[model samples]
Target: MARFLPAIGLWGGLALVLVAVNLLIVEKQRVLDDGRTVLLALRPVDPRSLIQGDYMELRYHEALVPADAAADTASPETDGRVVVALDADGVATFRRFDDGGPLAADEQRLRYKRRAPSGLQPDPENSELFIGAESFLFQEGHAEAYEEARYGILKVAPDGSSVLAGLADSGRRPIRP
Candidate 1:
């Protein structure tokens, strides 16, 4: 019975881990399927990686943290939600930091992280604020397909959690490999 107890513990722990992982996958899948689509204008960066295939560093044109806001010493590092107003085309433009109030009809919330520059950014001297992912990876030969990418399509949940669905061109067409 003592030997069986160890085996039982190991199997029980693995089961718990699997369940937790599966739950996360299920939640993200739900977000991708049912969340509102919001397009964030992209600021182009490098798009080639010889060792790891093609990728694009993503910077949101509409989501830049104001210099003053990033410089605020009161809260040097923070994670919170920011409100954006969606246009007719579903493109989102930053409105303000979320204050836990009701959002306007055209507005949606997006999660963000503000911190010291990681030095990997184009403007490393400035503080950094980012939403979703910092880069998008694609197949090695598909660099050209994403070169004209003008917007990052995000599927955003009601609670401000988001998933980077894909990249879109100027006409808002997905850039498929």
Candidate 2:
């Protein structure tokens, strides 16, 4: 009975892992298809791993909700929802439609679901940005992932909407797009 119990536990754990991995793969593809393409300046981090697999860490130049803007109610509750509007200069600016701030100069937009606990204030010296999503915060090696991410404006949607979809490079289109 004891030996059987151990085997059952192992198999159960393995099954659970497989299911979780499959879900991640599906979501990855989904984000690729529908998620916004954020072009960020990538800062690579040391790579390491355990049960799942090894992955590169990344940080972004365009990750934060501009510290100056954070004070404004336009900043959604952590991980709430933000529409990233691009200016003619191609800079990506964020605002919550609910908050009703005027859109930036450009009509291009991207959507990012708010992440809680907030992220770091924008520091010019460091081009790194934070992901406020709970999943990003607690994943096993996510710290490294965020540390190495390349930051850039993913893409611009019409009518003040953003893609807020995934973590990867976007097709380049200057800053405003």
Candidate 3:
């Protein structure tokens, strides 16, 4: 009986792990396939050597929260969510830091994890917010092509959980391998 118990534990553990991994993969695919698409500008990146072999590292402009009206009064909590509203051009802009408040019809809530506080309080020139999917490593050796990318294509879920799917050029076309 004891010998049987050990085998059962081992198999059970492996089964649980596999189930968790499968669920995560399924959720990610769902986001990529059905989530809302938003285009975010890329903060200027040095193109000199952005490409390494095949994949390129990506950074997005939307990841930084601008010190707009709502940002100024919000508390500096790294583990909270933020509501964003799209500008006329479909660019996501910070509407307010999450405060458990009501949102405007156009606003979408995005979960945020603040990096070390910038110390620079919310102001016109220099505040930033750290949203997830800040960096992406794509296939390598395509540096020159991706260097011209100015936007990051993000698939944002209804709850504001977002992922950087790929990079895009000024024309908003996906920069594929």
Q: Which tens-of-lDDT digit does each residue in 1-177 have in candidate 2?
A: 887998999999999999999998776566556644444344444455565454444443433456455445534344333455544444454543334455544433343443233365433332222432212122554544344334433433333233333344333333220
**Runs in model 1 with CA error above 4 Å?**
62-64, 72-77, 119-126
Better of 1 and 2 by lDDT: 1
Alpha-carbon TM-score of each model against the true structure: 0.88, 0.43, 0.77
Kindly give the number of clashing pairs for every candidate.
0, 36, 9
lDDT of 1 by residue, 98-175 (tens): 888999999999898865655443332456678887899987778888899999999999999999999999999988
Q: RMSD to native for every prediction?
A: 3.2, 9.7, 4.4
lDDT of each: 0.83, 0.44, 0.69
**Model 3: per-residue lDDT, tens digit, 24-93?**
9999889899987777777866533433434444555644466463245445564668777876655676
Which residue segments of model 3 deviate by more than 4 Å? Answer: 46-55, 62-64, 67-73, 117-128
Candidate 1: global Cα-lDDT?
0.83
lDDT ranking, best first: 1, 3, 2
TM-score of model 3 (CA atoms): 0.77
